[model samples]
Every structure is written in structure tokens, then in C-alpha cells.
Target: MAKGTKSTWSLRRKLILAAIAVVVVLGLALGLGLGLTIGRNGGSDNGNDNGNAPTPTGSPLPSPTGKLPWTPRVNDTWQIILQNNIELSDDATSVTPNVSVFDVDMFDTPKETIDTLHRLGKRVLCYWSGGSYEPGRPDSDQFQKDDMGKELDGWPGEKWLKLSSDGVRTIMKSRVELSAQKGCDAVDVDNVDGYQNDNGINLTEQDSIDFLSYLSNLTVPLNMSLGLKNAGDIIPSVLPIVHFSVNEQCVAEGECQTFHAFIDAGKPVFHIEYPDNAGSKLKEDIVQNFCGDTGDASGSGGFSTVLKKMDLDGWVEYCDQSVETTALNSTDQGS
Candidate 1:
């Protein structure tokens, strides 16, 4: 009777072990099938894309190769000081008003300042002339005389460049490379509206479109963002490639509607309005005129607006009626 019991127990143990092995094999097969399905779909149901998802129609442009560039979102707070480089000590831990991004002159801004801003958790947008020739830039002499066009009306020593010129594009490529080297998160390409201005080179809207594409080619590989500066007419053409819009006086000119497309596209509009008394204390009406949501300021609801001096100095007034001046080194530079 004891021997019979032992035989029965051994058979039962074998049966249980075989059942466990079958369950383990089934789990492995199910996991493998799920992994292959997720791989084919480019992402899992958890909403994380593995860089293989299909590019959606009308989406913000992605880089051709390498990692994607920084994309500034709608209404992201910012401060732009193009007149001079910011003043930040190496050991400092904070900046005034504590904005998310700072736009400074690319050539005037030292690498050390950019590094410090990064340490303080702020991104830097290096400002440079993409469609114009400025006299004192380090690459000023590299611009071919044939590429130089008519002088800008109010900005002295700066002339529009032929957007189609190969020489101009080469110089711009170098500037983009320099921006990458300086730890700049993005580049603000100014004067792209040369097509609207009296550009002597007969720059058409198509020229601006092509030029931005060329710039995108250079900026994308470096993992740097690019911004459109007041070229609202070509927004439809270049919007996919650019990450933001550095609009000047859209509120004052009643053209804020044209730039709202960036906001709609999930990109920021770094709007700047130079009120009459912006250099000093601003009056209530002036603030309302630029920052109010009604009338001229309609469709500008998500703009990152800043009331700055015409000179674009350090003093900045936000839509909240709060004013702050960024500290700057005495060394000044032209835009």
C-alpha cells in the first residue's frame, strides 16, 4: 500500500511540472508577438514614439538626420536683448524675471555666458542677420559685393542680401555652425522679410521660402532651432521648417493675425511691441493698447509678448504689467 502511494505521488509531481513548463512557454511566445507588433507600429499604446512614427501632415518639421532640434511651444515666456550681451556671473544661479529663454546677439554673446545661462536652466536664442549684411560681423567681409542689396531704411550699415545667392547661403551656413558651437539652443534669423522690403536684388517670396529650407538643412543636423523673423507672408511656406516666429510690432501694426498661425501650429511667437514710452515707465493706455486681447491685439492670445524699447535694450514689460530689466554688460553691439 505504501509503494502504491509513492508511485501515485511521483506521477502527480511530473504532471504539475509539465503544466508549469507549458505556461512558461506560452508567456514567452505572447511577449514576443506583442514586441513585434509594437515595433511594426512605431510605438506602443502608451503614447511613446520611438522615432519611427509616420510624419503627420502639417506637423512641425523634423530633422533630416541626427536628433531633432528644440521646438519652442506656444506662449513660452522669453526675453530678447539684442543691443548687448547679458551680464551673468559664473557663480550666479538666477536671472531677472526668470524667463525660459533669452535671445541675444550671436557674435556679441560669449560662450561662457551661454554656458552660465544653461547652468541656470535657461535656453539661449542667438540672434543673427540671415537675409541682411551687417558691417561689423566677423563674417562681414566674406559676403560678396554682388550679394549685397539695398540698405535697410532705418538700420544703418545693414543692407539686404540676395536670398538666392550661393555666397550668402555659405556664409549663413557658417553662422549656423557657429551658433551650434556656442551652445545656443536656437537661432533667430532676422530680416527674412527682405522680400517685402526694397531689396535691390528682386527677392521674391519664393526666395525666402527656399532660403529657409537651406537654413533648416544646416540647423537640423546641429540640433539647433530656427525662428522666422517677421516674414508673415511666407509663414505658410516656411512654418514647417521654423520652430518659432520673432515678430516685431505685429500688435502695433495690426498684423498680429498674420503671425497667429505660429501659435496655432504649436510654435511660439516672440512678439515685441515698442510702445511710445517703453524706455521709461509705461502709461496704462499704452500697455492696454499692446497687451490687451481686444481689437488690434486679437488673435494674439498665445503670443509671448514683450513691450521693449525701440532700441531693443534690456528693459522689458510683460502683459501682466510687470516690468524687469535684464542686466547687460556695458559692451554694446549692433543687431
Candidate 2:
């Protein structure tokens, strides 16, 4: 072979080898880049990855007390009138001592009231506003202007809160801590269904689901049962987490069946029907229609019904023709 031809063939062979080496290096680099990207994305569905993805930093499930296994069932007779500082009557004979539960305002119901009920062997559920901002509450000023959305209709000085706000959740956490501190058995977190009303914050059902999940995580840890208050639409999502359902005027609004999910889940639905003359006079028909017919409202079986005034004063009339009214002094009337 000629020297020039041999040299040219050698040079061509070297260029091909160099090109192959470069391609191999580029392929390895691309694979490494993709592996790093997947690791940063935390591409695991098991929720165990802690790379760039956010780690859930809050409380855990099954609670510290192990998810309240207690189910509040119907025929569970109860009395709850959240007026100001009215005490449960010491005279058990005259006051119907068979009452199973008593729900009262967290702040207004003094520790003595809870102690008195406990002495009477009654379960007490402390009430708190978990979604709305009330001007009279102790933590009212803690709510930021941005956290408030709009004033509630017909309710003066009360505003709907942004369900996703950290500030609002902090205040609610304080309220739950207060309920636990008060030795209450359960918590009736009110105004949780702000999405159902004109909340002005564009809150959705998912927002309420997240909020209730957060709330249940808080209360269940303290061995305190939590009640879903009147947010029937999100029942399927929240029923598994909550222990009871406090429904208002389901018969009037024709939404009683929505609450039956709680009952079907072996949980209690504390049904309250506020008739037109609830405060002034007791309407026999309203009481009969609510608890009487099994199919009157929505073909659901029996429900624990109570006749209450709009303001939720101490006056209560059960299906069995029993009436109990609180006797409050001027100071007890916190207004």
C-alpha cells in the first residue's frame, strides 16, 4: 500500500472512533440528567419521597387518641341551648336528667356548667365558630382583613373567612385547644359550610373538605368528637372524619336526606327544625311533621328532632311533649 493512502485510512479510522466516543458520552449525560429530574420531581406515588416536593408537615391520621370510635346514634336524647352563661339545673328531677348531651357556647358556658353536666352524667359538646369571623369572639382581632371575605347575610357584624387562610386556621386551632381545655366531650364547629352561601371568596367543596380534614385531625387527637354543622353537600367527603351531624331546618329546606348519610354511617344526626313561631310559641304541627312521619321529609327513617328558636335560646321541646327552658339572670345573659 502507498504511504499517503495508508495515512488517509488511519486518519479516517481515528475520526470514526472519536465520533463514537462522543456519542456514548452524550447518551450517558442525557440519562443522568433525566434521572436527576425524576428524583427532584419526587416521582413516587407512595408519598414517601422528600426531595423537592413538599412534605406534609402537619398532624397525622388515626389521631393520638385513635380516631374516636364512638358513633352518636339517633334516639340519643340530648339538650343543647347555647345562650349566654346559663347553668344546667341542679334539680335533676325537674330538669329531665335523662339528657345524654348538652352543646353550649365555648366561652359563654362557664366551666361550672360543664362540671354540673358531668356531675349529672351528661356529655357536653362545646360550640365554636370555625369558619366565620365573629366580632365578639376573643380572637376576633386575630383575623386579618385579607382573611375575611364577606359579611353574612342577615347576621350583623359576622363575616365569612377564607377557608384556606393560615391565620384563620391558627385561630381555630386555638378554639379547639380551648374546647379541649374546657373538658368538653366533643366540638360543634359552626359555620363550616361557608361555600354554600354567598361567601365571596370562591370557596369550593374541596376547600371545605380540606378544612374539615384539618379540623378533625386537630380535635380527634384530643379524643374529642367533631360534628359537621349543616354542610350537607360535603357529607360524603367529611362523614368518614366527623363523629356527628348538626343539621338545621333540613325539613324546611327539603335537604334532610343529605344528612341521612351520617346516620347510615352509624353516626348521629342531631336534627333541629326552627319553625316560624319557634321563639314566641311552640308549633305542634312542626314538631309532629319532623319526628312523626318516617317519609314526611325525605323517606329517611327516624331522626332525633328538636324544636328550637332562631336565636337558639334555652327553650327546647322534644317529640315526647317535654319542655325545658333555661332561667338566666341579667348577668348570665351576656348581651
Candidate 3:
């Protein structure tokens, strides 16, 4: 062959080889891109790339938002008394009213008290302010000024909280963690309905709903039941996320039906009614009037009513004509 002709043939051969390499690289790149898209869409059930598998096209799996296994449910026939410090009887065999549930202050009720109640086959619900800042609470200082909004009307030193604040959520999460650490079966998150009040920050019902959703997300993973404390307006929205409803003065306010949604949904409403005069003084008429004597207490028959004083001391009067006060020793009473 001529020399120039040989050089041109070699150049043509090199060009052909380069073109082939480019085609192979392009094919591999396309395959990898397709595989990644499939994997990103959640690998197929058969563990193979089958184009027949439908692509997830809508709403992106809800953005992994809110808590899971929501609306932690509590068992029925459980007696709950909201008090500062619940004292066990002298025999210590069982608590009074044959109570099966006790809701006491997180700070005041000791671990031993919860253990005692657990020993008696009772479930303990630790009470704390989730949306309010209480002055006397141990973690009171953790609240930032921006997290606080307005003072709760009747609660002297307590104030509403900014539910969306990161600082507030972190503090509230720590409180829930403390409840679980203290062996509480559930937590009573109080004053969540700041939107209903003049909460100073113009908080809306949606804010409360989002806050509860956040809290439910935190509580459920810990296997802890989360109770909604008197946030009636958002009941329809949060009913599916909260386990129970801890209501105060619903019957007295003639709004028992607002909380009955929990009962309708097969969750308990731990109802509390404060007699105008009873400061830990058990009154039979109050119990009968509230808990229903022949269907008279605000007409909703199945309410679990407990007569407590305004201060929520150890005394509790139940519907079954049983009255017992958890006696607090001087130290327990904070004397």
C-alpha cells in the first residue's frame, strides 16, 4: 500500500475505536441514570427494574411529616385524679376510689408514687404545661422571652407559649422525655388551647393543631400516650393524633359534647369538675350532678367525672359514691 494511504487507514481505524468507546460510555451512563430514578422512587417490590412499576407521582409520601402511630389510646375503666401530690393510703395496698388512673403534677409526684400506682395495676398520667410556661416548674428558666406570649387568665404565674418556636418545642420535648423517664404511662399536656384565649401573639387554631401534631410525633415514638388538655376547637383536626382528652369544667361550661368526640372515637375523656366551694372537700351532690345520677349531669351519660377543688388537691369524689383523699405528708405538701 502507498505510505499516505496507510496513514489515512490507521487514522480511520483510530476514529472508529473512539466512536465505539463513546457509545459504550453513553449507554452505561443512561442505564445508571434510569436505575437511580427507579431507586429514588422506592425500589420495585420484586427487587427488579420492571418498567411496569408505577412511578410515585403525587404528594411525595407526605414529606415524612408529623408523628406516627398517632393518637395513643388508653384503656377503659381507668380512674384519673388530677392533683398536686397523690398520697397512698396507710395500708398502701391500693389507692382510694379504687382509682385505676392518676394524673398528678410532674414535679410534685415522685417516682415512688408512680411505682406504687403501677404496683396496684394503675396507670399514671404525669401532668405538665405543654403550651404554657409555669413559674414554679423546674425547667422554667429554659423558656425564652420570644417563646412566651400572654399570661393564662386564671393561672397566676403561667403564660401561653408560642407553639411554633423551636426553643419552645425543644423544652416541651424535654418535658415529654422526662415523663417517659419517670415511668409515666401517659402525659397530660395542659393549656394547649392558647389560640382560644387572648394569647397576645395572635396564635390561631392551626398553630395549636400543628403544635399537637409535633407533640404527638414526639410522644408516640417513646410509647407514651399523649392527652389533649381542653383544646376543643381543634378536636376534629387532632382527634386522630391524640390519645385522650383531659378536660376541665366541660360539663360545668355546658360543653361536654365538644369533648365527647374523644369518647365517640373510643378514647377516654378524663373529665374534671371543680365545685364552686369544695376545696378538696368531697361533695356527693357535686359528683352526682356532674357524673350523672339517672342521666342528669349535662346529659352525656358516659363521662368519667372527678370532683376536685380549684387547687386540685389530693381529694377526689367519684360517681360511684366513693370519696378518698390522697394524704400528703408535710414534705410532700412542700411545707
Candidate 4:
């Protein structure tokens, strides 16, 4: 889920909005109509691609403008905190389990934090909410009133974005740009499941596909990896562009199998199961429903699972009941 609210933060964006719009529309048109795109789902190439655009056949665009930082491997162990910014007080490379990656907020986390992780030999996955507009963000003013749809369920101060808008995709691309600038190895975009919610904009699954592919233009050429956060339905068409999957509560929702195709294709599904509210932990038996052998098969053997609190923080409990909290000087943001 979001970090502060449900499963979802800040970055002041200052760019030529008008230029971004033109670039995105033209690039999307060309990729859909003419070019030979490079990436593909490599597995389970199912689903008629949104029908609005054909399966991409050319190189991605708005093409990467610069160099990329890193790419995560399949089944790489990782940790994420989207709702808060941290002030780390210890060596980043010394954490237990020697997890290979860390996913944190874009603006909230200082660039030095990302630098530290790099020094530790760990890759950083920058996280941001691409499907919702949050208040008080750096780019808050960039959103036109109609650009925001219904408020996210239980996630106050956030509203589903009009993903189909040229402006929205432009802003989202800037976020990925921000991630690369901050030295993030990959981008973890959330709330893409907007089509499944009662989002006031009437946003459809096609809107997400178009938006996600456009965002990839900036990542692929730079070599930074991309991840789909919890929009399993579009996987068949989008699998090729993304490097991994960051899912929320699939086992609890009995939808783990929906993402197994990623596994079959040799991609990692960074799975999270949160059965408790913040400041609490799930009972051991209940935890097994997500982590044990009998649980969701997509995550059973190859999945990288983490038992976390609803508000993702440093506190973490693995399936084996092994608990650890990465060293931090501070905690949760806007909770």
C-alpha cells in the first residue's frame, strides 16, 4: 500500500509543461504507430494491449535524456519506505540479510541517503505515487483542478489523477527524471491500480498502459530499471517494459496467482503482506497465510516476501519471524 495513507509523496517539479506535453504525445504516437521498441514482457504476452495503442514495436521514448544509475536482478532482496524520509545513523552496507536493494521516497529521502546506499553496494529504487496527486508536494501547483479525480479511499489528501491527461503523464515523467537524478537504480510507481478503484476521472486500464509506457521512455535508454506497483491486470501487455513487480497484499486478497507470470518470466515480485495496523504485528499463524508454504503460490517459492506493518517503516518481520529495523534517526512521514 501507500506509505502515509494506504499504498503511496513530494518533489517540486519545475519544467516546461507545454514542451513535455508535446514530447509525450508525439513520442506516444510514433511508438504506437511506427518505431521498433526494445522491451517486451518476455513471458505471458497475453491481453489485447489497451486497444488504444498497438503493442510497442520501436525504441522507447521520450527517450532517456541521460545516463541511468542501476538495474535490479530477479529475486533481489529489498526494503521500501514510501511514507517517510529517513535520517540514517549507521553504515548502510552493514544491515542484516545483506539485502541488495532499498526503495524510498524521491523528495523525502535526501540525495545523500541514496549515495550511502550506493556505497553499501546496494541499489536504490525511488518510489513515488504516479496515479494520485498529493497535496503539499513540490509539484502540487502543477495539477489543474480537473486533473485530480476522486480522493483515494481512506487515503486523505490524495486524489486519483487524470492519468489520460497530457499534463499528468508529463509530470509523471518528471518524477522518473527526478529519480534518476537522485541516483536511484529503478523507479517504483504506485496507485497504478486506479482503474480498479472508483476514481472519479473514469480512468481506464488503457490510460495506465499508455502512461506507463511513456514513462519507460526516460528509463530504458538510461539503463535504470522500472517496476509496476500492484496493477496485475495490465501485466500481460506491460511485462516487457518493467524490470520487476512490487505488489501489495496479493496473498491476502487471493490474487497472488495474478502476478505469477512475472515469476515464470524470470522477474522478481517484491511481495508485501501487511496484516496489522501501524504499531502492531500479525499473529504468527495469520502471517503464514502470506508467507508459508500453503499460501499464495506466486510468492511461495521464488517470491521475495516481507511481512510489514500497514505503514511501511523500518520495522520488518520476515516469514521466519526474524525481525529487524534498519538504523534510522527518524520515522514515518505524514502519518
TM-score of each: 0.81, 0.76, 0.72, 0.76
- Candidate with the larger TM-score of 2 and 3: 2
Clashes of each: 0, 0, 1, 15
Q: Pick the candidate with the highest TM-score.
A: 1
Model 4 quality (TM-score): 0.76
lDDT of 2 by residue, 1-335 (tens): 69999999999999999999999999999999999975554332212211222212222454453323233555577767776656446554334426787878898887766877778767888888888999988778899999888899998989999988998898899988888888888899989889988998988889898999998788877767788999888987776678788888888777788888766655677888877666544566666777665554773456677778777777777887677666553343211
Summarize candidate 4's per-residue lDDT along 1-335 as a digit string, tens digits. Answer: 36554322222122456678889999999887554332333112313211222232332642234323244545678777665665554464465436888888887998888887778777888888899999988998898888988999998989999887888878887887788788887788889889999998898999898878877877776556788999989999888777679988888787888787777767778988876543345577766777764555434566788877777877777777676666554634312
Candidate 1 lDDT by residue in tens digits, 1-335? 99999999999999999999999999999999999985554322212121332211232344454245556666678998988778889999898869988999999999999999999988889999999999989989999889988999998989999988889998999899999999998999998889898888899999999888888878876878788999889998888778789999988788998998887776789999987767666787888888877899987888899998888878888888888888888653221
Best model number under lDDT: 1
What is the lDDT of every predicted structure here? Answer: 0.82, 0.74, 0.71, 0.73
Q: RMSD for each model, in Å, please?
A: 10.0, 11.3, 10.8, 19.2
Instruction: Output the better candidate (2/4) by lDDT.
Output: 2
What TM value does model 2 have?
Answer: 0.76
Look at candidate 1 and tell me the lDDT of residue 110.
95
Q: Which residue ranges in model 3 land beyond 4 Å of their true spot?
A: 1-84, 88-91, 279-286, 293-296, 331-335
lDDT of 2: 0.74
What is candidate 4's CA lDDT for residue 86?
Answer: 57
Q: Which structure is stronger by lDDT: 2 or 3?
A: 2
